[model samples]
Target: IRDFPTLMTKARICDEDGKAKSSYYKAMNDKKGKGLDRGKPYENKGNGN
Candidate 1:
């Protein structure tokens, strides 16, 4: 849910339901967990792409 606003914005642009989707997901499952270590950027070929 960290990217909720951005997800909603993108969903609005694409005419999708991001918030409802995330809510449904959260409803069906627990949000607590070890989670991922996001200290580093999720790079994709960097600037050289």
Candidate 2:
């Protein structure tokens, strides 16, 4: 969300329902929150590898 603040805005511009798909949205959910951060960048614990 913070990383791509204009994502939602761009999606809504063409589609009022905000259901339209674009490259930005494709790349966003593509990760499936694998590296998403709720607080700090290291909040999600892992081997960091």
Prediction RMSDs, each to the true structure: 16.9, 15.2
lDDT of 1 by residue, 1-49 (tens): 4689988877686655667787889976774553575444557556775
In order of listing, the candidates' clash counts read 0, 0
Judge candidate 1 at residue 45 and give its lDDT.
50
Candidate 2: regions farther than 4 A off: 1-21, 36-49
Each prediction's Cα lDDT score? 0.68, 0.67
- Candidate 1 similarity to native, TM-score: 0.30
Stretch of 10 with least lDDT, candidate 2? 16-25
Query: How many angstroms is residue 20 displaced in model 1 relative to the true structure, after the best TM-score fit?
Result: 0.4
TM-score of each: 0.30, 0.24
- Local error of candidate 1 at residue 43 (angstroms): 44
Query: Candidate 2 overall Cα lDDT vs. reference?
Result: 0.67
